[model samples]
Target: MTEKTAGKSLGVVGLAVFLSAALGYPVLIVAGRGLNPADGAVFLAFWGVVFGIGSALSPIEQEVSRLSAHADLRGGRVGPTALRTVAVAVIAVGVLGAVLALPPVAERIYSADDISLGLIALASSVAFALQFGTRGVLIGFREVKPYGGLLVTEAGVRILLLCALLVLGVTGLLPISVSVALGSFAFLPFLVKARKHVDFVGDAEPWSVVARRTLLLMLSAGLTASVLTGYPAVAKFFAAKEDLDALGSLFFALSLARVPLLLLSPVQAMAVPTVVRLLQDEDGHRRLVSLLIRGTLAAFVLAGLGGLAGWLIGPWGVRLLFGDQHVVAGWAVAGLVWSSVLLGAVLLLAAVLVARKQPGRVLLTWAVVAAMSVLVLAFTPGDMVLRSVFGLVVAPTVGVFVALGLVVRAGSRDTSVTG
Candidate 1:
């Protein structure tokens, strides 16, 4: 895409991200207030699993976006490739469903016998795949307006459904959970509209290549989500039984601290394409280096400010929103916010590595971070909240460094092609 076109896409997508972020809070607020502490804790764990899987499976979107953009450049159709991707995603979801259906896994994750949640989880997976696949198509074709609309629709419908449930006094876990799951499916109208786009029409990569690369991307995304979207659920496994009840506060604080990520998510969706476009430019390497330096600086500055705010306001913020039942210490809030900022930076760097076609490096980076976090969570001694905070703060710090190193090395060897 031309620089002017890129700028326009950024503006539209940025606005949509803003709207999505704003609309999203009501859903969280309602969820926090409507459920008692124990139920809220259970629901938060459920929320983490659903979103974590969605985030983990986001590679479908990323791969499709990358493939679609390259296909467009080659004057080829990515429609068939997109279809194959959906099939692979379906198969993956089937496996995921089976695992989640296990009594052991379901009992721990859901903390309730509600069989409906299992069904909702499966359905949500399908919706997540379709949602990401459709989004990939729009993004590949540079359909920013439609892309932006999809974002708003998903968030707006979620808030509306959740709020409606609240108004009806149906704040039980099942109803609210279903309401949350429906947000992924709210993109149906947008999907129909997406079908009319010309980009999904021609021949592209072989299925084997797509599947292999997609699996690698999925692995990387899964590890990343374990910390970002899935952390609460993952934490439940390692956290002492006594600490689990109190996790409601930590999870709430973490969610609030992650607001910036929600707002910045749309930008992340565009990261691979933006980096790919840069890689295709004549003076790409130097430009990529400059971008990395600036991005690192920006991440630190923004994180520093966010940490300060969390330290001062986050303690009272959760209390005000969810009552005294949930209260995270200010230091923990600040640390979580800092971790999120670093995680965002790591994601951007991973995009650069992906654009360079270095999936192994990306996978390796997240693996290290994930392992580090899990070890800390398992072995660290302290209050559960502090332990959680330390693990989160340390993991992403490692990811940013590892990913940056990988990106730099990849750039040094070859910036113009898959290395």
Candidate 2:
């Protein structure tokens, strides 16, 4: 049992991830049908902003988890370091939320009386910051059950709250949105329960160095979040007024296409350890390249199949699941699906880069892909669906090429891999 900690933890956490992701679809559907088209779109946009903020702050969790694990291995304490980091992260996110709540931004994102909504967003951001931090502490200590419990707890809380609101005949956008923010507090129970037993003692790094590394991670993650979780908010900003009505359908299609990403994104974490092991070998570079080449080929084939299915049944499926108001074109759905799979491929390559300790390349990959994708969305001469398709497709395609180029260049430096 002791020897199986890694595998067991991963299995538990993986199931938790799957369940949390699976719950998201139903939550989206309930929210979509619960509100009118315009309100549903607004809710989604708000959802994106809040969750995007959370995603941007996710690096703290990663950093803390890594630090905690290293600290435990070294027989040090990480409690003080983790607490300080969490404090900084929460404060930073709070400031960001405040900026978003400023009259101009708030008005655009929420109702005319947007103070309440903005406050909700701010609260949610802080909650998510703490949630991530706590989970990091749990997982870093190899407390997989606790970590998994937190994930399920948060999802369950959100869904139950949403259902309760609906049952009580409260379907207002603001009210519905509260469920999301409040759900993040699910970590509190777990945190309190294990506080005394948890060992947070760990060696501390210099504050400046820690801060710098965290900022870089946040920047890279922010870019990725802007492309993934934040795209809905992007669409709301760039879309023409006439196309606004169809925003619900566009968002619905986007969510459906992203279902695969939820499952595949976790693969990046799994790949990191494997890649690190490979890097220790004499012919590691060659082996890594060969492995990725095969993986890329598999990604392409799977993406092609997913795209075809999206083209064939994507529209019908959305209509059946979300209703006529959420109708989108098949080709656009196909593009979205294809883009998602490609992004998964990019994630795999990113794992390699991360394992190789090449932060610069990782940022470069996201930078190029994210910028180009936004540019395509903003300037493409077409309807919303066409623009979205082009934008989504451009992200992962460009990302794949850029990441591959970087990987190959890195491989070139190794004597084991002659190009």
Top model by TM-score, which number?
A: 2
Query: Candidate 1 has what TM-score?
Result: 0.85
lDDT of 2 by residue, 180-284 (tens): 888878988987744643455555666777677777777888888877887887666676446656776778788888988887757776798888787788888
Per-candidate local distance difference test: 0.80, 0.80
Candidate 1 regions with alpha-carbon error over 4 angstroms: 1-9, 66-78, 113-115, 142-144, 196-206, 263-305, 408-413, 416-419
Instruction: Report the lDDT of model 1 for residue 182.
Output: 92
lDDT of 1 by residue, 1-419 (tens): 78998888888988886887678677778877777766776677778778888887877887778767876787765667777786788678768866775666776666655556767877887788888888888888777888899989988888888768767879898888888889989779887666764344566578898788677667778898899878987776665546755787788888888877876777777888888787777778778888898889899899889899999999999889777778777888899999999988988888888778777787888999999899898899887777789999999988888888777776452644454
TM-score for each predicted model, relative to the true structure: 0.85, 0.92
- Return the TM-score for candidate 2, rounded to 2 decimals: 0.92
Q: Cα lDDT of model 2 overall?
A: 0.80
The collision pairs in model 2 are: 76-201, 76-202, 77-201, 77-202, 78-200, 78-201, 78-202, 79-200
Instruction: Check candidate 1 and list the clashing pairs.
Output: 77-202
